[model samples]
Target: MQNEGEWEAVRLLSTAARLVRREVDNRLRELGLTQERVTVLRVLAGDGPMKRAELARRLRVTAQTLGTSLVTMTRQGLVGELPPAAEGGARRVVDISEHGRRMLGRADEIEQVGFSADIRPELRRELVSLIHDLEVHRAGASASL
Candidate 1:
């Protein structure tokens, strides 16, 4: 049996994550971006050009999953494959297209507006702090694992 504190923590995290994801996705959708695709774009934007495997790692997604996403995005012209970065197997570097950047800008704008209007400044600061703490804890947990 779980302790009340432990149970409440889990429940709170689950509910909050679901709600946040839904809102973020809704905002992204308004800009013609899906959550998965937005995630891919964000990873690429931060990491610079990357191959599919690298992208999968950064996104915490499987290669197969990222591959399928890349295929669709490629078809949609959101990203393009260039010469591979490193050795062995085609480098297959992926970069965001001009259109993808525009879409990302719009989605980011929407997120900013929503966060500023819907969430109180104090709550936003607290949430950011909590997320930082969670990341520290998660790193420690992963190390132990």
Candidate 2:
């Protein structure tokens, strides 16, 4: 049902997304982390402690998948599990460790010298806005179906 130009736009966007992830993952690998791990750390660092289910939702991953990553991160001391408060039930909370913060700092340094640094501010803003709009539209479409 889509026109040629629309299909091309989607392909371009998908390719761009994959390329960006690849580049970021490559840079993060130098610090012994994947883009996904850094993303989890960054979210915890910026947002404070959060329940695993909520964190998984925010990261758009299944809880099972996140649990696997958490296992590795926990063993590596990059993330810490906090005891559930007496009143808050038994849901475990995850927080970034001091080591994780240091790792995030390193990741930030890498980002500064990475491809993101070359993007103009205005262009970056436009891209971000477009991505957000696409996400909202997708969410609405999924909900309707």
Candidate 3:
């Protein structure tokens, strides 16, 4: 016999995530930014300049995936690649552009207004913990593979 009213945890989480993504994306659209782009901008702004490979690790994405975004972002003037740190060396250092920072600031404003008090602090902490745990599990699984 099956339980009459079992909760579907994964389905609920997925739906909530989709809705939140939609809302955030819509808000970001006003600034000509997407969530992915905003994430890159935030990391660069917060961490300062670094190589693309290092950026990829910080972003939790593969080099090739980040490369595609970098190409478009560079062309769109949201990011820039600088000369090697050494005079006679070769390295790719990237940083967020002024325009990107402006957009990120706007995005921050939108996010602050849109979600500042929606979720309770306890629930938010639980969600964050859950996400961290999942990421750790995922990394361990990938390593095993």
Model 1 segments beyond 4 Å from truth?
1-7, 84-90, 115-145
In candidate 1, what are the lDDT values of residues 59-85, reduced to their tens digit? 888999999988888887888888754
Please list the residue runs of candidate 3 whose C-alpha ends up more than 4 Å from where it truly belongs after superposition: 1-7, 88-90, 142-145
Q: Write the per-residue lDDT of candidate 3 for residues 1-145, one digit (tens) a residue.
A: 5442464878778777788889888988877788889999999999999999999999989999999999989988999998875567547889999998888889888888875347788999999999899999999999999
lDDT of each: 0.80, 0.89, 0.87
C-alpha RMSD of each candidate structure in angstroms = 4.7, 3.8, 3.1
| Candidate 2 residue-wise lDDT, 35-127, digit = tens | 889899999998999999999999999999999999999998999998888886656899999999999999989888987677889989999
Candidate order (TM-score): 3, 2, 1
The C-alpha stretches of model 2 lying farther than 4 A from their native spots are: 1-7, 88-90
TM per candidate comes to: 0.70, 0.83, 0.85
Best by TM-score: 3
Root-mean-square deviation of Cα positions for candidate 1 versus the true structure, in angstroms: 4.7
RMSD of 2: 3.8
Which has the greatest lDDT?
2
